[model samples]
Each structure stands twice: as C-alpha cells, then as structure tokens.
Target: MISVYHYMTIAAILFAMGTYGVLTRKNAIVIFMCIELMLNSVNLTFIALSRHLNNMDGQIFVFFVMTVAAAEAAVGLALMISFFRNRESIDVEEIDLLKW
Candidate 1:
C-alpha cells in the first residue's frame, strides 16, 4: 500500500516544478499553466489527506479548489488573449503595461 509520505512527496515535487516554471518562464500562458500545476499539486495533497483520514472534508475542499481553478483559467486566458491582441506579442519582458 502507498503511504501518505509518497503522496506528499509527489505533491512537493509538482509544486516545486510549478514554482520553477513560474519564476523562469517569460510567457504569460506558460506561467498560467504553471499556476494550474501548483493548484493541482495542492489538490493531490488534499486527496491524500482525505484518503488517510477516511473523511470527505478534504475532497470537498478539492472541489472548491477545482471550481476556483476553472474560473481562474477562464479569466487568465481572456486577459492573455486581450494582451496579445494589443501588443501583437506575448513576451513578458516586452509587453510591460505598467509603465507611465
């Protein structure tokens, strides 16, 4: 049987990879994907705990997280599309929109 440690370790690795991608990637879409990866990693932890405790609370929380993730993906993709349309490029370094 798989232990909690195994699940947790997998979650940790996924979260780390997502973090690294967010920090190193310049494309907005890639960063968005990484954010989703991080969210999924958290969901994995929640599921692991839920199974270990034989409770529904963790699974319920995962449901909520999934809902939020869906909303975030929709809004993030729309924003990226709008930005790309205006800038004609999606490169993070060149598409600075905060300048005066």
Candidate 2:
C-alpha cells in the first residue's frame, strides 16, 4: 500500500529535478517553469502530510501556497514578457535591464 513516505519521496525527487533545471537552464521561461515545479512538489508534500496526520492545517496551507503561486506566475510572466519585448530574447545571461 502507498504511504506518506511514498508521496514524500516522489515530492523530493520532483523538487530535486526542479532545482536542477533552475540551476542549469539559461532560458527565463524554463527557469520559471522549474520554479513552478518546485512549488508543486511542496504542495504534494503538504497534502500527503495532512492526510497522514488527519489534520486540515497542511491542506489549508496548500491553498495559500497555490494562491501565491498563481500570483507569482502572473507577475513573473508579465516581467518575462516585458523583458522579452525589451531585449528580444529571454536568455538569462543577457538580462541587464537593471544595469547602469
């Protein structure tokens, strides 16, 4: 039977993959997606633990996390779009819009 440990393991693996993508990818969108993946993994963990403990706290926290993630995605996409418009590319290495 599947247990909280299984879910936790899967979440950990997904978080690791997301971390790797964030560290190694140069594309702004890919990095953004990786960040989302990491957030999802955390949500999974919260849900799993909440179920295991028969409590509502972790599940409630997941709702807050999701809300923040949605807001972040909107703002992040807007920033990326603006950056792309200004630079004509979303490469992280070329992001110097804030440079003097």
Best TM-score goes to which candidate? 2
The C-alpha stretches of model 2 lying farther than 4 A from their native spots are 96-100
lDDT of 2 by residue, 8-50 (tens): 9999999999999999999999999999999999999999999
Residue 52, candidate 2: how far off, in angstroms? 0.4
Clashing pairs in 1: none
How does each model score on TM-score? 0.93, 0.94
Candidate closest to the true structure, highest lDDT: 2
- Superposed on all Cα atoms, the candidates' RMSDs to the truth, in angstroms, are 1.3, 1.6
Clashes of each: 0, 0
Backbone clashes counted, model 1: 0
Report, for every candidate in turn, its global Cα lDDT versus the true structure: 0.94, 0.97
Error of 2 at 96 (Å): 4.3
What value does the lDDT take at residue 39 in candidate 1? 98
